[model samples]
Target: MYFSIEPKTSKEDLFNFDEPYAALKKCIGLNEERLVVVFGLRRTGKTSLMKVVYNELDMPKIYIDAREIFPLTPLSTNQYLVSIFIEFARKYDIIKAILEHVSAVEFVLRAEGKEREAILSSILKNINAEMQKRKTHLVIFIDEAQLLKPTGADRLLAYIYDNLKHIQIVVAGSEIGILEEFAGQNKNASLFGRAKKQITLNRLRPEQSFLFLKKGFAQAKKQISEKELMAAITEIDGIVGWLSMYGWHYLKIGSKKALETIVKDGSKIIADELEAFLSYRGEARRRYLIMLRTLSIREMRWNELKRTLELEEKKKINDSHISNYIEALVNYGFIEKEGINYKLADPLLKRGLDFVKI
Candidate 1:
């Protein structure tokens, strides 16, 4: 049977680009420079971007996805560092063996009151020791990397980046705001003033979405009307995951009415997410989410949003407060703005707002 959701092939998965190779080339060009901050709203293809660019670099590379190793939410920065390094040691044999050897030194150093620093300090020493013995360069990538607790990660990254000549380190995450929050401008901090390059991964434009849809339908041996295809794109606002879901939904429905149902059903998924946002505690956050939802459905002027807020009987929110709410939302990565206009940065959120009652 043909599949609608098979892992998009490396070539076909280039979702939004007529020339993904060119995009990959731009990313590869960054390798000659210092750290590149690869970030985007969740599922805007940040990880895919990393994979494509990293593939071009011919080096001994390691990709560590932090999502796989759950972040310790309650831990302090120092404690988090210990946990992260322990996890790192347990997984990579070369790093593990090197650390184990350093633990011997650590045990001795503990008696001299240097045990705390010994683990991290000696790990670096061991990396150099290994490099001399093995004669190779190391490129390490940490994914979902925004989750790394700021305090400890700052110190660790700074030390590694400052000292390690042979190891090229790259950190990427789905949430750009989270990373910016982590890398605050404290000179003593790990990544302070250290991001040599920053890259933003956004959704495929409308034209790119059309191309991907056509390519995907051909692969699945299905044909879609231009109206149906454009409807899906408008509904999902050009997010790849939602586009793929539309393709999957289109394949299962045989009738035109069934197609309408798929769109309606998808809208409900959007609505549920919107309800969750509005109901979430923090009045400013709720208002911001609601405002973004409204913007997604139809553009509203500043005073118009105030008027709309006043009309809501259940939501006793203030018109003047909307600006502050929008600022907070933008800071926290929930929404984005261009001049006076603003909208939900994530398309799924847009669908959820569409599901919300007028």
Candidate 2:
């Protein structure tokens, strides 16, 4: 089970995060209705932690991986909500007719904003009432919640939080793209001023990282020395997902190049996701790539990044431009700032960024 690399759902699959597991239980138990935001960098187990909470709680739940969702297009925010709900209903086997008129509500009707929210609100109320009749609470868990387009999502979710007594939505997302800002922390964003519970996952400690690999190999009935496990911890720097990838290939192909294979394979995965974020940036792609490539090897100061960009562009770049670019990357969880230095947040992504060749 530990050898499995997909977003884990069962308790038996995840390795660590005792603190976060407890925190999640308390949040759902204490708050009758509240927004709980769980976030971390890519490959850091935010999704797995969400699954642990989803499975632990005694409730009716719906889990959506927002990464599988694309951004909004040719629709109002309410339409986005309707579309996502439609997807949810289809995936979870929620009786379509129990949704009442949801199937009948056409896309044309959703564009009329007020009526659409009313429709959605009514469906949620019905679902909540059913949940109460069954003596179970409703938890709507959206993992990779950052990938959701902000537009009308917060306002609609805010409505559900306020109007439904038996239903609550808990969202988990990576820092990869706009997740931090979309989370209603912005005064202008919907769900603003409402109290929120946030739990951020950090990388595994050195000892825990070694144990994770040790236990994973043991589960596979493979023999790997403690020294080899420690060497891996040092090489990969304690990211659980990346470590799992290395362990997966190492088990399949017992050679030194398995390490190189992880890097090559990881870059393709991280780069594909990164490129999706980059696509929405328009003409600013060059500048962002420059910054990411530079930070791959060294931490940088704000001004230093600006000067480098200006020299490369052969044109004057303003403070706001540089700041905005970095802010976007930070929001998505691709880059992080500590003190005055800025650097890529994921070690595997840093290795992958080298191949990005900005």
- Among these predicted structures, which one has the highest lDDT? 2
What TM-score against the true fold does each predicted structure earn? 0.72, 0.86
Give the whole-model CA lDDT for all candidates, comma-separated: 0.59, 0.74
Model 2 accuracy (lDDT, Cα): 0.74
lDDT of 2 by residue, 1-358 (tens): 7766676777788888778887887877344546888877878888888887787776567777765545444244445556656665555456553566565457435446566667767667667666666666677888766556444666767777777767777887776446655667777767777777888888888988988888889988999877777767777777888888888888998636667787788878888778888877878987899888888879999998998889988999878889999998888778889899998777777766655544
* Residue range 83-172, candidate 1, lDDT tens digits: 444455455456665656545543443333345555555666666455546665556667777677443565666676677655666667
Please estimate how well model 1 matches the true structure, expressed as its whole-model Cα lDDT.
Answer: 0.59
As a whole number from 0 to 100, the lDDT of residue 218 in candidate 1 is 89
